[model samples]
Each structure stands twice: as C-alpha cells, then as structure tokens.
Target: MSTDRTDCLFCRIVAGDVPATVVATTDRAVAFRDIDPRAPLHVLVVPREHHPDVVALAAADPALLADVVALGRQVAEAEAGGQFRLVFNTGPEAGQSVEHVHGHVLGGTRLGWSPG
Candidate 1:
C-alpha cells in the first residue's frame, strides 16, 4: 500500500515504523489498543493511508472507509460484548489528538450520551 504521509502517527504504525499493540489488521485498516483507554475495551481503528480525519478519509477513499468500519466491528465483536460504540473525532477540539483518520471502539461498560 502507498502510505503517503511520513509524519502521521497512525501511518507510521501501519508502516511498522512505530510500535503499537496491534490487535487487528486488514489490507486497508488497523486496530490497536489505546494508550489512554476510556473504556475497558478501548481500541483504535485507523486506515493505512493518511487523512486528516474521518470526513477527509471518506472523501478520499470510501472503500477504505468501509474497511476501517468493518475492522472496527470485527475487533469490537471479538473483544467488546457485541455492543460497542464507534467514535470518530474530527479535530483536536473534538478530542482527535492524531491527524490521521481513526475510529475508537468503546464498550465493556455503559456509554454516556455526551461523549465526554
């Protein structure tokens, strides 16, 4: 795959340049344990390619976006008790610390509506 960005953290993880506790991987997406997990089953699912956020990724590659969601679902089904929430924070203000597009699979507890 042609991972474009060198500075993107998720891209680095996908390229095997950075170390992460990877739990799942597909041709277009990867899932790993979050460093600071909010839920008991908090995993981060990211695309191999670099996109600023989910909206950018969806615009750039809708198929890859589908792969990301599927990968998240696969991980959540195996790890979380079949009931999980998928979250995509678009910007830093929205809690997206990394620039690369990613989704968070959260479960193993009751999730609040506010998403704090």
Candidate 2:
C-alpha cells in the first residue's frame, strides 16, 4: 500500500507483516480485534495507508477522514449488535500505542467513562 516501516505498528498489520485478528478489510482500511480491549466488543479500525494522525489526514484529504469514521461506525453497529462508542487515541498522551491513525469501536456492554 504505502511505504513500509512507517514507524507504525498498525502499518505492519496492514502490510500483513504482523498478525492480527482481522474483522473486516477493505481496499483502503482494515478492521481488527484490539489486543488490549477495553470492552467485550473492542475493535480497531485502521487505514491501509499510514497517516501520522487525524490532524495530518484532515490536512491531506478531509474526505478520507470520513471514510475511517464511517467504517468505524459500520463495524461497531454490526459487531456490537447495534450501538457503540468510537474512540481515536491521537497521541501518546491520549494512550495511542501505535503511531498509525486508528479508531477504536467499543461496545457490547455498558462501558464506563474510564477504561477498565
């Protein structure tokens, strides 16, 4: 897709160099199970191409940002049985482990404000 070794773990997953419990995959995105899930239905929706973060994506192509959001909602509604929350851990301070941009879809139960 994009250049390899984007200094992002999610990039590796997208490249298939790393293993992940993929839930769904598209030409532009990939949905996979979160390793450290905060809820019973926790999935990470990541773009096949690496973007530094949301801000970068917005500046590059705003419409692309919508794709990630839409896909996250689709995955959440489908897999969580109806409703869920979408989360994007943008930076290190926000608990983003991987540099590649991603949205976390959490549901399947009443998830509290603080992650469990």
Candidate 3:
C-alpha cells in the first residue's frame, strides 16, 4: 500500500494540510472527530501512515492496526464512559467514503441496532 496520497482527505488531515477536530494522537495513530457524526461520540482513529483500508492495514502492519484500535478505545473511554463500538468500513458497499483505513469510535449514548 502507498505511504501517503496527496489527494486523500485523511492524508491531508494527517499532514496538517487540512483541519480536523483532533481528539487524540499517538506515534502510530491519530484520532479526530468525524465531520458528520452518527453519534454523540463519533471519533475516527487512523494510522499515521497511509493504508487503503483496514484489511490492507491488517495485512501490512498488524501492530499499527492494533494501535489504531487501542487509540479508538482510549478515545471512547475519555468521551463515552469506556463503552464504544469500533467500526471499519472496508469498501464503498460497506460505507467507506475515504480510502484511508480508520476505526469509527461511536458511543456516548445507548446504541441501537439499525444498520440499514
């Protein structure tokens, strides 16, 4: 997978080329608030390095993938009382709008199961 894509939105955010409501960061990951939040606590945890999707990230760097998830949990604990749902949308059909691999941390309220 590519390291950085100049045209990628998340890459721009990571590079400080674009502004984001950053919640947290680590050597391996960055967590920021989602523009269109689906929940009160809607943060996205992304690896500092670029990877097309979560599967690519898992295959190329499992540790980085774990780092992303760990950051997501950290954000959840701080923002959502330690309970959250981590979602990785792999493709367009799966609701992945950006190419960069990210884990959506959703919580802050009682969640409902309506994946339609």
State which candidate has the highest lDDT.
Answer: 3
Candidate 3 lDDT over 7-94, as tens digits, reads 9999899989999999899988999999999999999999989999999999999999999999999999998899999999999998
Ranking by lDDT: 3, 1, 2
Q: Candidate 1 residues 5-110, lDDT tens each?
A: 7878888888899999999998778999999998999999998878889998888889999999999999988987688999999999999899888999999899
Off by over 4 Å in 3: none
- Give the TM-score of each candidate: 0.93, 0.89, 0.96
What C-alpha RMSD separates each model from the true structure?
A: 1.6, 2.0, 0.9
Best by TM-score: 3
The candidate 1 region of ten consecutive residues with least summed lDDT is 1-10
- Between which residue pairs do clashes occur in model 2? none
| Model 1: colliding residue pairs | none
Q: At residue 94, what lDDT does model 3 achieve?
A: 88
Cα-based lDDT at residue 62, candidate 1 = 93
